[model samples]
Target chain A: MTETNKTWVLRSRPVGDIKDGDLELVESPLAPLADGEVRARTIYLSLDPTNRIWMSDVDAYLPPVGLGDTMRGGGIGVITESRFDGLQPGDVVNTGLAHWALYNTLPGASLAKLPTLPGVPLTAFTGPLGATGMTAYFGLMDIAKPKAGETVVVSAAAGAVGSMVGQIAKIQGCRVVGIAGSDAKCKWLVETAGLDAAINYKTEDVGAALDKHCPDGIDINFENVGGEIMDAVIARLNDFSRMPLCGLISTYNATDPVPGPYNFANLLMRRTLVKGFIVIDYFPRFPEGIQQMAMWLMEGKLKFETDIVQGFENAPASLSRLFEGKNLGKLVVQVSDEPK
Target chain B: MTETNKTWVLRSRPVGDIKDGDLELVESPLAPLADGEVRARTIYLSLDPTNRIWMSDVDAYLPPVGLGDTMRGGGIGVITESRFDGLQPGDVVNTGLAHWALYNTLPGASLAKLPTLPGVPLTAFTGPLGATGMTAYFGLMDIAKPKAGETVVVSAAAGAVGSMVGQIAKIQGCRVVGIAGSDAKCKWLVETAGLDAAINYKTEDVGAALDKHCPDGIDINFENVGGEIMDAVIARLNDFSRMPLCGLISTYNATDPVPGPYNFANLLMRRTLVKGFIVIDYFPRFPEGIQQMAMWLMEGKLKFETDIVQGFENAPASLSRLFEGKNLGKLVVQVSDEPK
Candidate 1:
C-alpha cells in the first residue's frame, strides 16, 4: 500500500464552467482508522453533473463541498481495512457520498457490500445496479408513473439515469423518445437502448422533431436536461402529463441565473405534474428498486455503458466530459485496479 | 328585453397589451333560441387575469377566443327564456364559458343554477362561490395539500383566487404569507384575511421581505402572478414544498417569450412538486369545494371582497384593473341590474 493518499480538494467555487485550479489534487499521509471505521480503495469514482453542483457555493440538495475539503462524490470501492464486523478487507462496497479520493475512510455501517451477480461486470454496479439505476427506476416508475401506451420523453437520453429511464419506460410498454446532444448518442438511444425514437438536440429542431414523433403528445417527461429542451417537451405535453425532474445538467455551471422553461405556463394549461427529485431521496426504497432492476438486468431487458477515464489524478478534469457531452452513459474515473 | 344585444367582439389579437380596436363593442340582433338553449341576461361578468390570455392567439387551457367572435368570459345571469326542461325564467345561473355581452345564449344543461344562501349577497357567487373561489379552493387543498403548521405563500394575494387561498390555508392551520402589488392589498391580506405577514412586491425588496416573513421557508406556493414575485417565493421553498401553479398574470401580456422563475433549480434542490391547474378541470368537484367555502363564509372564517365595475360597456376596459393591480378582490362587470 502507498504511504500517501491522493484526494481532489475544492479550491474555489466556479463562476461558469469549471476551470483548472478550481479543485486541487493533494496528497496526504493515510491516518490510522478509528474503531468501527473502514478504509476502502476507490475502484470507480462516479463523475456526475451533480458533482458540479456540490462544487458551487449554492443552496443545493446537499451542502456545497466546503472550500479546501475533499470534493464530495459517490464511488465503488473495495475495503482495504476494516474495524467493524461483517465488512472484511477485499469486500467490494458502495461508498455513498464519500470523497473523490484514491482511498476513503468511512464508518463500516455506512457502506453496503455489493453482491456479485453472474455475467455482470463490476462496472454494472456503477451503472445499472447502482444509484443511477435506482434513480431511473424510482423517478420514472414512482414519480412519472408511466402507464402502458403513454408517450415518454427523456432528455440526456444517452446518459446514465436517462438511458435507464428510457429503457424502464420502454419495459413499462410506453412509447419512449429520447433527446441527446450528439447523433451518435441519439443513434445509441434508439438502436441499443430500444427507444422508439431519438432526437439529436444539437442537430435537429427539438420542437419540430417532438411534434413529428410524439403525435399523441408527451405523457411522461423524465427531465434530465433543463432549458429550451424542457420548454419544447413542456409545450407538447399531453393533458395531465407527469415530469420527473431528476436533473438540470444544462444549467449546472451557469454563471448567470438560468431561466426556467419558457413554456412553464403550459404545465398549468395541460395540468402537468412536475416533481423534482434526487436518487438519495429514494434510498429507503433502494431494495425494491435494486431487486426489480437486477431482475431486468438478468433477463437481458436493460443495457448500459460506462465511459471510464483512467487515473484518480484526472478526477476534476474528467467531470467536464459530462458537461461537454464528451462521454456516453455513466461517466466514471477508474481510480484503481479491481482485486483479481 | 332589448331587440339588439351588445357584445364585445375580438377585433385583433393584442401584440403586448390590449389596445383600442383589439375588441369592438358590436350590436347584433338576438337570434331565436334553439332547442336546449336559454337566453340569459348577463348580470355579473367576471373580469379575470385569464381574460387577457383568451384575448391572445396563444394555446391556453381553453381554446383562445377566436378573432371576430364574441369575447369569451364567465358571468352570472338570469334566465329570460328557456327551450330546455328543468330550467325556468328568473333563475340565476352561472353562464359557464359564455360571452362578455348584455345577454348570453347558452345550453341550459351547461349552466349551473346559483343556490340562495341567506345573508350572502348575489356578488358572493362571483367572489367566493364562483370559479375563482373554486380555483383557490382546489389549487390549495388538492394540489398543494397544505399540512397544519406548514408555511404557505400566496402571490397576487389581493386578487380573487389569492385572497381565498390565504384564508383557506389559514383555516387549515398554516402560516400564510401574501405578496401583493400595493400597500392597501398587503394591508387587507394581513389584517382582513388574517395572514401571518404580507409583502408589497411593488414597493419592497420581494426577496428580502420573503426571507424575513417566511423564516421557516415556504411549503406551499399558490402561484397566481408569475414573474419576479414567483421567483422570490420559489427561492425560499423548503424541501418537499408544493407549488400549485394557478396563473401567470405577470406574463399574460408579455410581447416576448417570458422567462420563467430564475430559482427554477431550487425546485430540484428542494424536491418540490409543481403542478399547473385550471379551475374548469375541477368542475366535477366544485360542489364539494363550494360547500366547504360556503360553510366557511357562513361561519365568518372566510372574508371576501368584490370590485364591481358598472355596465357591460366597460367589460373590456375593466379587465385592465386585474393586470394593473387596481382591483382589491374579484373584479366583475355588472352588465345589468339583478332581479328586484
Candidate 2:
C-alpha cells in the first residue's frame, strides 16, 4: 500500500518576521517502515516562539532547522505501523521536533506514549499535557519557588505556559500579577486565570503599576517577554527574588542584538537569582508533571486555552502568532484526524 | 582628657573621578565617652570601590554618604578610652563604616573584637581577615559552587575580593583564570596566587583569550568589573554556568548610567545563572567562613597582597587607586600607628 504525505519544509532562514514561501508545504510518498522503526500520522503541531529561533541560523537551544528539512515542531502523532517491540501500531505518541507534517517515519524509541488524561483533548498533549505545561510547572515550582503571600509576577501571562504559571502560582498562595499586551488578556488573567492583578504592558506604566500592585516588591518573576517589561519588574524585585529566565520573545525577531536590562544591577543589590531553564531538562519527570497538571485540569483549578489553526499549510504563519500577541493562549496547528 | 579627631567629610558628590576636595578632612573636637560608649582610634581604613558608590547619592548596598557626614569605611581600630563594660582601653575592634577618621566615639557593641593570628598583621584585619575576605568566600563558594576540574573566571581578579575569589576557587580544585587591567596584576595572580591562567584585559582581546583559556566554556564567573569584561565572559558560559555578581568597579566612576552587558541573553541561551550577592547576607556564618579561609591562609595555600596608602590625609585621594588599577590586591589606608 502507498500513501501521499504533506509536510512543511524549510525554504530559507527568516530575516526578521517569517514570510510566506519561507516554509513550503510539499507533497511526498510515505516511506515503508523498517526494523526498529514506526510509521505515525501527525495529529497536532505545536507552534511556538522557539519555532522562529529554529527557523533562524542563530545559536539556540536546538540547532537551526536545516534548509530543505521538515519544519521542527512538538506534536502528538498516532502510530499506523510499527516493527519495534517498544511501540505498537495503535499507540499514540507525544514527541519533540515531530515536524509540521501529516505523517512521519522514525525510530519508535524517540516518541513517548501519550499519557491517558481524561477530559484533556489531544490538543492538550501539544500544550498543557506536554512540554508547554511542564515548562510552566518547573519554571515556577523549581526555579521561582513562590511562597505563600509572596508577590509573584509573570510576563506574557496570557500565553499558554504563562497562563498556567499564573494559575499555579495562585495555587501556591502567591499574589499573582501578570504582564500582557492587551487589556482583554489582562481581564482574562485576573478573572479567568486567578491572577490578583494584570498590567497591560501596552497601555500601563509598568513601573508605577508594579509599585502600586506589588507594594511589598516582587519575590518571584516568571519572565517570558524580555525588554523594558523585564526591566520594570526587576527594579521592584525584593531581596532574594527569583527570575526563571525562560524566553525572550521580544528579541526573537530582532535584526540586531538585544541589550541587557538597564536596571540589571538590581540582580546584585537585591541579591536576585536569574536562572535560565528549558522544559527539556525536566523530561525525566514528564510523567509526574503530566499527572499533576492533569489533576489540576480535572479539578478545574487549572485552566488552559488552545488557539489552534487547522491545516498544516498554515503552520509556519501561525508561529508568528506568539511574537505578534495574536494568539490568546497556546498557539498550535491541527494537521490530521485522530482515532477516538 | 580631651583629643582632636580628624575626619574626611563628603564635600561634594563626584562626577567622573574624585577630586582633591571631594572629601574634606575636617578636624573636630572628640566628645567625651558617655555611658555605654568608647573613644576608638582608627588603625587601618579600607578604601574600596564601594566608597565611590556610597559617595554618590545613588542606591547601593548602603545608603549614600550624605554631604557633611564623615566618610563611611571599613577598618580596624583600637579603643583608646571606654565607659562601656563590653570594651576596654587598647582593645582592637573591627567594624563596617569605620569612617576615614582618626577617632570615633560610639557604643562598643557595634564592633567585633579582631581574632588574633600569630603571623597575621594588623592590616590583615581590615584586609584579608575582614569583609573583603568574606565577600570572596561566600560569593565564590555559596553562589558559584565550583566543582573539581571546572573553569572559573574572575574579573577584577587583582582586587581585594576578586583576588581571594580566584585563590579560593583554586582551593576548590577549579581552573582559575584571572582578568586584570595590568600585566603586573596578571603576573601576580598566576605567579603568587597560583591561578591556572591570567588575561590582561587591557592588552588582550578578552573574548579570544577566554576561548583559549576556557576551551570547554566557563563554569563559574566571579564578576567584579562589569561592561565589556562581563559581556566577554558571559558569551563563553557553559550550560548551568553560575556568575556571582560581586562588584561593578568599571562603572563605579562613570558620569552616566552604565549600560548592561550586551550578551546578557546567554543567561537564557546557555541556561546560565547570574546571582547577585552581598557578604552581609551571610553574617551569621562569618565565623565559619573566616575559620575556613584562615586555615587556607595558614596552610600557605592562600597568599594576600596589601596595598597600604599611608597617612590619613591621603585617604580620600587613595580611594581612586581601586578604579585606576594602582592597587595590587587589598587596598587600604593606614590611619593610625599600631602599638610596638
Candidate 3:
C-alpha cells in the first residue's frame, strides 16, 4: 500500500464549461484511520449530473459543495485498513464524497458492504444495481405511477436512471419511448432495453418526434434533461399525466439560469402533475426496490449498460463526458485493478 | 305571465374587451313545460369569470357555448309553471344554462330547490352561499390542505372564493394573507375577514408585500388570479407548498393569450405542488362542505359580501364587472322581484 495518495480538488468555479484547470490534482500523505473509521482504496467512482447541482450554491434537495473541497462523489472501494470492528481488510464497500483519491478514511456508518456476484461486474454495484437503479425504481413506481398500456417517456434514456426508467416502464406493461443524445444510444435503448421507441434528440426534433412516436401523448414522463426537452414534453402531456422529476442534466453546466417557455397553464389545461424527487427520500423502500431490481436482472428481464473509464487519473475527463453527452450509460471510473 | 320572454344571445365573439354589442337582447316566444321539465322565470343570474372560459371554443371542464346560442349561466328562478312532480309553482330553484333571459324551461336534474330563509336576502342563494362557496370549500380543504401555523395567501381576496378561503384558513388556525385589487378590499380582508395581513396588489408590489406579510413564505396559495400575481406567489413558495388552482380571472377577458412568466422550475426547487381543481369532483363531499359553510355563516364565523346589480337587462354589465375587477365578493344580477 502506498503511503501517499493522489486526490482531485475543485480549484475554482467553472465559467461556461468545466475545464482541466478547474480541477487540481494534489498528492498528500495518507492519514491513520481513527477508532470508528476504515481506510479504503478507491476501486470505482460514480460520475453523475447531480455533482453539477452540488457545485452551485443554489438551494436543492442536498447542500452545495463548497469550492476547494474534494469533489463529492460515490465509489466502491476495498478496505485496506480497518479500525472499525464491523469491517475487515479487503472488504469491498460503498461510500460517498470519495474523491479521486487512491486512499481515504471513511466512517463505518458511511460504508456499506458489497456482495460478490458470479457473472455481474463489480461496477454494477456502482451503476444499475446501486443508487441510479434505485432512483429509477422509486421515481417511476412511487412517483410517476405509470399504468399498464400508458405511454412513458424517459429523457436521457440511455444514461443511468433514464435507462432503468425505460426498462422498468416496459416491465410494467407501459409503452416506453427513450430520448438520447446519440443514434447509437437510441438503437441500444430500442434493441437491448426493450423500449417501444427511441428518439435521437440531437438529430431529431424532440417535439415533432414525440408527436409522431406518442400520438396518445405521454402519461408518465421521467424527466432527466430539464431545459428544452422538458418544455416539449410539457406541451404534449396527456390529461392527468405524471412527471417524476429526477434530474435536470441539460442545465447542469449552464453558466446562466435556464429560462423556461413557461407554459404552466398547460398543467391546468391537461390536469398534469409534476413532482420533484430525490432517491434519499425513498430510502425506507430501498430494500424493496433493490430486491425487485435484482430479480429483474437475474431473470434477464433488465439490462444495464455502463461506460467505464480505465483509471483514477481519468476521473475528471470521465465526469466531463456526462455533461458532453458522450457517455452512453452509467459512467464509472475504475480507480484500481481489483478482481470481482 | 307574459306570452313572450326576452333572452340575451351572443351576437359575436368579443374581439378585445367584451362589450354590450357582443350580446343582443332578443324576444322569444315562451315554450310550455314538458315532462320532467319546468317553465321558470329567471330571478337571479350568477355572473362569474368561468362563464368566459365556457364562451371560448377551447376544451375545458365544461363544454364551450355554441355561437349564436343564448349565453349560458347559473341562476335562481321561480317555477311559475311546472310539469315535473319534484317542482312546484313559486318555488325558487338553481339551474344551469339558464340564459340571461326572463323565462326558460329546464330539466329537473339541472335544478336544485333553494331552501327557504325568511328575511335572508334571496340573492345570497345566487352568490357566496351558492357555487362560489362550494368552490372555495373544496379547493382549499380538499386540495391545498393548509395546516395550522402555515401561511395561506389568496389572490382576489375580496372576491367570492377568495374571501371564503381566507376565513376558512383562519378557521383552520392558518395565518392568512389576502391580495386584493383595491385599498378598501384590502381593508375588508383584514378587518372583516380576519386575515393576518392584506395586500392591495393594485397599489403595492405583490411579491414584496408577500415578503413583508409572510416572512416565512406561503404554504398554501389559493390561485384565482393567474397572471403576474401567480408568478409572484410562485417565487415565494416554501418547500412542499400546495397551490389549489380554481380560477384565472386575470386571463378570462384576454382576447389574445396572456403571456405568463411561467416559473415552473421554482416548483422543483421548493418541492411545491400546483393542482387545478373543479368543485364538481368533490360532489360526494358537497353536503359536508355546504353544511359546514352554512353553520359558519349562521354562527357569524363566516361573513359574506355580495355585489348585486338589479334588473335582468343589466346582466351583461354585471358579467363584465368580474373581468374589470369592479365587483366585490360574489357578483349577482337580480332578474326579478323577490317574494314577500
Candidate 4:
C-alpha cells in the first residue's frame, strides 16, 4: 500500500461542463483506521453523471458534497484492514458514497458486503451486478414494469445502466428501441443488447424515427438524457404508459435552469406515469435485486461492456467521457490491482 | 317535444380566450331516434378544462373536435325517446361526450345508466357524483394513493376535481392543504371542504405558505393548475411522493406552448409520480365509483358546490369561469329544467 492517497478535492463548483480545474487531485498521508472502522482500497472507481450533481450546491436527493471535501462517488473495493467483526481483510464491499480516492476508511456499517457469483469478475460488481445494475433492475421492474408485447424506449442506450434496462425489457418480452448518440452505440444496442431497433439520436430525427419504430406507441420510457429526447418520447406515449426517470445527464452541468419537456402536458393527457428514482432508496432490497441480476448474468441473458481507464491519474479525465458521450458501457477507473 | 334543438357548433379554433363567435349556437331540427339509439334532453352540461384541448389541433389522448361539429362535453339528462330495450322515456342516463345542446341522439352503447341515489339531486351527478367526481375518485384513490398521516397539497383547490380530491384525501386520513386563486375560494376550501390549510395564490406567497403548512413535506400533489403553481408544490415533495395530474387549467387558453415545472427533476430525485387521466378510462368501474360517491354524499361525509349557470345562452361564458378561477365547485350549464 502507498504511504499517501491520491484524492480529488472539489476546487470549485462547476459552472457548465466540468473542466479540468473543477476538481484538483491532492496527495494526503493515509490515516490509520480507528476502532469500529474499516479501510477499503479502491479497485474500480465507478464514474457516473450524478458525480456532477454532488459537486454542485443545488438541492438534490443528497446534500451537496462539501467544498474542499473528497468528491463523492461509489466503488467496489477490497477491505485492507478491519476493526469491526463484520469485515475482514480481502472482503470485497460495495459502497454508496465513498470518496473519489485510492483509499477510503469509515465505520464498517457504511459498507455493504456484496454477494459474489462464480466466473463473475469483481469489475462486474461495479458495473452490471452492483449499484448500476440494481438501478436498472428496480427502476424498470418496480417502477415501469413494461409488459410483454409493449414498446419500450430507452435513452442513453449505450451506457452502463441504460444497457441493462434494455436487456431486462427484452427479457420481459417487450419490443425495445434504444436512443443513443453514435451509430456504433446504436449498433451495439441492436446487435449486442438485442434491441429491436436503435436510433442514432444525433443524426436521425428522434420524433420521426420513434414514430417509424414505435407504431404501437411507447408503453415505457427509461429516460437518461432529459432535454429534447425526453420531449419527443413523451409525445409518443401511449395511454397509461410508464416513464422510469433514472437520470438527466443532459442538464447536469447547465449553469442556468434547464427548461423541462414542453409537452409534459402529455403526462396529463395520456395518463402516463413519470417517476424519478435513486437506487439507494432500494438499499434494503439490494440483496434480492443482486440475486435476480446474477441469475440473468449467469444465464447469458444479460450482456455488458465497460470503458475501463487504467491508472488513478486518469480518473478525472475519464469522468468527462460520460458527458461527451466518448465512453461506451460502464465508465470506470482502475486505480489499483485486486488482492491476490 | 320542441321542434328545434339548440346546440353550439365549433365555428373556429380560438386564438387565445374562447370567444362567443368561436362556438355558434345553432338550431337543428330534432331528428327521430334510430334503432338501438336513444334521445336525451340535456339538463346539466358539465364544463371542464379539457373542452379547450379538444378544440385545439394539439396532439392529445383523443382526436381534435372537427370544425362545425357540436362542441364536445359531458351531461346528465332524462331519456325523451328510446328505441333500445335497456332505456325508456323518463330514464336518466349519463353521456360521456354529448354536445353543448338541448337534445342529443346517440347509440345506447354510448350512454351509461347512472345509478339512482335517494336524496341525491340530479345536479350532484353533474358535480360531485359524475365525470368530474370520478376523475377525483380514481386519480386520488387509485393513482396517488395518499396514505393516512401523509400531507396532500392540491392546486385549484376550490374547483370541481380539486375540491373532490381534497375531500377524498381527507377521508383517507391525510392532512390536506389547498391552493386557490381567491380568498373566498380559500375560505371555502378550509371551512367547507375541510382542508387543514388553504393558500390564496393571488394574495399569499404560495411557497412560503406551503412550507409553513406542510413542515413534514408534501406526499401527494393533485395538480390542476400547471406552470408556476405546479413548480412550487414539486419543490416541497417528500421522498416517494405522488402527483395525480388531473388538469392544467392555467394554460388551457395560452396561444403559445406553456412551459412545465422547472423543478420537474424533483420527480427523479424524490421518486415522485405524476400521472394524468380522463374519467372515461374508468368507465368499467363507474358503477363502483358512483356507489361510493353516493354513499359519501348521503352520509354528509362529502360536500360539494356547483356553479350552475342557467340558460343555453350562458353556456359559452360558463366555460371561461374555469380559466378565470370564477367557479367555486363544478361548473355546469343547465339547458333545461330537471324532472320532478
Best by lDDT: 1
lDDT of 3 at A246: 82
Top DockQ hit:
1
Candidate 3 vs candidate 4, TM-score winner: 4
Which regions of candidate 3 deviate over 4 angstroms?
A96-104, A255-257, B97-100, B117-121, B253-262
What iRMS does model 3 reach? 2.9
lDDT, candidate 4, A1-340, per-residue tens: 6578889999888888777888899999988778999988898999998888888897799999888898999788888889988998889887667889889887898876776677777888877787889999999999998789999999998899999999999999999999999999998999989999999988999999999999999999999989999999999999899999999998887878777898888888888888889998998998888889899899999999989999887887788899999877999899888767
Our model 1 lands, by Cα RMSD against the true structure, at 1.6
Q: Rate the local accuracy (lDDT) of all candidates.
A: 0.91, 0.86, 0.81, 0.88
**Candidate 4 structure quality by residue, lDDT tens digits, B1-340:** 7678989899999888998798998998997778999988888898888898899988787888899998988789888888988888888888777778888887887776766778878789887888889989998998888799999999988989999999999999999999999999999999988999999999988899999999999999988888988899999999899998888888878888777788878888898888777778898997888889888999998889999998888888778898899999999888888877
Residue B161 lDDT, candidate 3, scale 0-100: 86
Consecutive 10-residue window with the lowest summed lDDT within model 2 chain A = A112-121
Model 2 chain B poorest 10 in a row by lDDT: B120-129
Interface RMSD for each predicted structure? 0.7, 1.1, 2.9, 1.1
Better of 2 and 4 by DockQ: 4
Better of 2 and 3 by TM-score: 2
**Model 4 regions lying over 4 Å from their true place:** A1-3, A109-118, B108-118
Q: Candidate 2 residues A123-211, lDDT tens each?
A: 77767788889999999998898899999999999998899899999999999999998998998998888899999988999999999
Where model 1 places Cα greater than 4 Å from the true spot, the runs are: A1-3
lDDT of 1 by residue, B1-340 (tens): 6679989999999887788889999999999999999999999999998889888887888889998999998779999999989689999998888888888889888877789997888999998899999999999999999999999999999899999999999999999999998999988998899999999888899999989988899999999988888898898999999999999989888988888888999999999999989889999999999999999999999999999989887877788888899999999988899998
- What are the chain A TM-scores of the candidates, in order? 0.99, 0.96, 0.96, 0.97
lDDT of 4 at B124: 90
Q: In candidate 1 chain A, where is summed lDDT lowest over 10 consecutive residues? A: A1-10
- For candidate 4, the lDDT comes to 0.88
